[model samples]
Target chain A: MELGPYLILASLEGAVTAAVLALTAVGLSLVFGVMRVVNIAHGEFFMLGAVIAWWIAHSMGGHPALGFAVALVVAPLVVGAIAVAADMTILKRLDYDPERTIVATIGLLYIIQQLTLMTYGPEARPVEAPFNTRLAIPWFENGENGWQMIWPWGLGTTSYKLAVIGAAMTVLLGVWVLMKRTRIGLVMRATQTDREMALAFGIPVERIYALVFGLGAALAALAAVLIVPIQQAHYLMGGDPLLLSFIVVIIGGLGSLPGTVLAAILIGLSDGIISVFFSPTLAKILATLLVGLVLVFKPGGLTGSSGK
Target chain B: MSAKAKIIALHGGLLVLLFALQFVLPAYHHGNLARIMVLASYAIGYNILFGYTGLLSLGHALFFAAGMYGMGLGIQHLGLSVAPALLAGIAAGAVVSAALALLALRTVGVAFMIVTLMFAQAGYLTVLYFGEYTRGDEGFVIQQAQRMLWGIDLSDATNRYFAALILFATCLAVSLWLVRHPFGKTLVAIRENEERVRMLGYDIFVHKLVAMIVSGTLSAAAGAAYGLLFGYAGASFASVQYSIFPLLWVLLGGAGTILGPFIGTLFMFYLIDLSSGLTSAYMLIAGVVLVLLTLFAPQGLVGELRNRIWRWLP
Candidate 1:
């Protein structure tokens, strides 16, 4: 009821959003950085992940946890395979020209969306969380009882939400390790730095690109799978994630992975917090305008990295 | 025939054909053609910046919506007549585009696209936020009584067709004149090589700004005219889908070609119209066409024609 508890509640909501956004934006950042091409269908991959998770969870005749576990592993792989196919078939043929890639990805976005609408049938479907236990959060206040912890009504979150945050962090850490401590990452980075040089070094640049594209899409799908329980899977649900992650990727200085995560958190938190004080639509308008102004004034982004 | 005479004849003949089609066509196709001509005008406006000047804006819908609302609001709230309301719509578009150009022009390439997209997104949200006035997505319709231009009742089918034709022809002629003029050549040259154009003592920023304004104004005129002719103003016209529509039309028709927008609009309109008769998933066809075009016919229908048969095609 009090402002402090309400703020805490909003922050908790914000954390969940930030967790999902970081994954999605990081995925976009990776593709944008490495391939130097914007994948407009990135959000479609996210939607596909959510939809596939729903399908798997719905079809599997088992405990919700078992279905969720299977979906967690399967959705990303399926989406990743699709991404690789698309990359090989379309983007590769175009030689990854920036403008053409954008146009092609837009076409991919339409196809993916239309197919989903056809099969998914334009309804929002919810995936049952593996587990949900409302845990009340304690708040401290300086009252007559002096620095006492008190349980506040409606100041709680589901166990599943907390697990999502934890899962996202673990996956993000894994991605960081893969990028920094793996030979594949080295080859990818080398290709990103200089394609011709990477080719000279026998890096098999095209295969690396395919791998990177798949990985990026897999990351987006993973985020969608994690969030699908909290948010329903729908055909049109991809648009917001696409726009928000796009803003995050740009604000995070394009290909900088850390910057993408940081920007995602910043945007995600602000979006939640702003909704508390203003109409949600107004908050969206302000955020969109803010991103436009930022791009206008600081095209290099807040991290000051002129992304290649 | 001389090349100049041939170019004139081609454009003139197309306009004449469009004008004559109104007499013999059935009602359904006739109405679709009128709507197509208005949308083609929007695409032509889009081409001025994208095809000719190499500035690919993802937010032309903002200008289009601005005009629609500008005219709609003027009539609804301010009680202005049709002609003044139309001018008001165009003015709104000019101002909005000018302001957006100032901010958006600072960024180039992908950044520019993102900026325009963001602003347009914001514009769409703003429309939703102010739902009391603009009616948001549900939209408000202009009354038939107000849909009169001078002594002519524009609500009549024949008058509407002629009005659309007049608008389309004006846009076409303007486009034709711009392309033939040195200013239009400069825009084409800038599209080819911005650095070289700048080196040749041209103020690239001003040129781009002007192109943006002209493009925005024309799009707004279409939006205004659409609301007036069709008797409705809706937020959907200001949406991302609307922004992409012009891009798709220009791309499919042949960007930078004078007649490309009309051909693209006509082809796309019919493609959707005819296909929607069979199935509701016409967008699937649209998606496939876009991908196939990028793969095989990157130059588009008119572009291919120009490359293969009409080297003198504008």
Candidate 2:
């Protein structure tokens, strides 16, 4: 591969990876903001989303985009509704005991994983890319010399992958605007910052928590829908990304949107570059260690307290 | 002297029974029994920090790993005999615990748990990264017989079981003693109210750090025993899942009590084994049980059962 074409490919990969990571990190941050419970099962929601999308595609005669679109909407609702139910039933009883809640959610994670195993079996389900045409640019071509990069950059993704990335960015932007500019967003921020004060100010803190948690679940589902194309759907795929996204949230500063975004991109790029240079497993180790170093040196995180 | 006499009598009776069982039981079952004893011992180490001190470290596996690897490394690299190898593992575990305690003790509550977890993961990754030296996931074997004192070789399953039982009983007694001591009282004070403990002139951080190091050291000793029994050491020894097993054992048995973790580990493993035998959906069943336990009885099986029994009696 020529340097220019490789650079373009690398950048595109960076963009897609960053988008997926940002989507993952945001949901975790949101839930932490509202409920004070770090939902260890959040990655299961992401995994379930991918599984749901794959199932939809399989059932709908292999229209992956339709599957993607369906998952984008339905996956989050299904997972969020389950989480909402959990919130109302088990988590609600725990109140704000984050430790007990952590234990409970870990138990939930295993339950979901085992259920997935029973339902889907232990095999990884392969997901086909919905769209197949690469956006190609005319380059210098020779039979013996092989094709070479020339001038104008030709960026390409199947219309499906492009659509997924586009949709994800739109959802993220919409969430940012919603949190920054809306009335409920204001309440969420206020509650996340201080629940007692918010309650004293006449806010229905319980409802806000449930809503925020549901919203976070939806975001994770969105990520799962988009991410299905990159990796096969599997019951245990959630474990790795769950650990990685947690590192992202911690390094990005807890509940800081901009920080999460920046940290996500940083982690995404590092993961991609490291995987390319070394083994994928080593990349994971490096990425985590980098986060730990940041944590030990700067406990407040990179962007340090984006308000609450 | 009377209390000491009672302890000696009880200890002698237990040793006599253990010796008798060795002759009656099949050799393999005795080995299996030894394995369970080692695991229960490991759980006890976990309970020392989690149950009594109220520190929820999700990375106790690190100490265990340290012990296992310390023995493996000592045997492989230093050509050390069994007793020295085990001692090396204990020493390594102590060093790791002391180092980790310094950073982890700075934070309290859930943050401390997360930090410890991160460190454990980091430790796992670090080991996996140096795959060449640590044999990575392939694991290393300790080929030597553990050192014998006088003429008693500990490599034999029955002898190992007796050694493990003795070590376990000794550690358990020490832990119980520590819990009753002035220092133990200070830890309880810190657990109940750290701010008040600080007000009363006790350095909460120092006490917590000490407790963590001591607990980790015992966990390390158990890890060494685990390595000796299994004869292999791998990264799985330091896995996140291994960390959770002890945490669950403590949670299910009840924290802040002697004999809780031992009972909890035995019950949990047996419940799991039985469930697996009954159906493949055992994990789901176990998960449900775990969730129910957390939601309904935070005090755990023993603690909850004791309360109910007391109520009935009253």
What is the clash count of model 1? 0
User: iRMS values in order, in angstroms?
Assistant: 1.2, 2.2
Question: Which lDDT values do the candidates have, in the order given?
Answer: 0.91, 0.77
TM-score of each: 0.98, 0.90
User: DockQ score for model 1, please?
Assistant: 0.77
Cα lDDT of model 1 by residue, B169-272, tens digit: 98998889998999999999999999999999999999999999999999999999999999999999999889888888888999999989999998998998
lDDT of 2 by residue, B29-77 (tens): 6776666667777787888788777888888988989988888778777
lDDT of 2 at B263: 67
Error of 2 at B63 (Å): 1.1
Which pairs clash (backbone N, Cα, C closer than 3 Å) in model 1?
A: none
CAPRI-style docking class of model 1 based on DockQ: medium
Off by over 4 Å in 2: A1-8, A136-161, A305-308, B1-29, B144-155, B278-286, B305-314
Cα lDDT for residue B95, candidate 1? 98
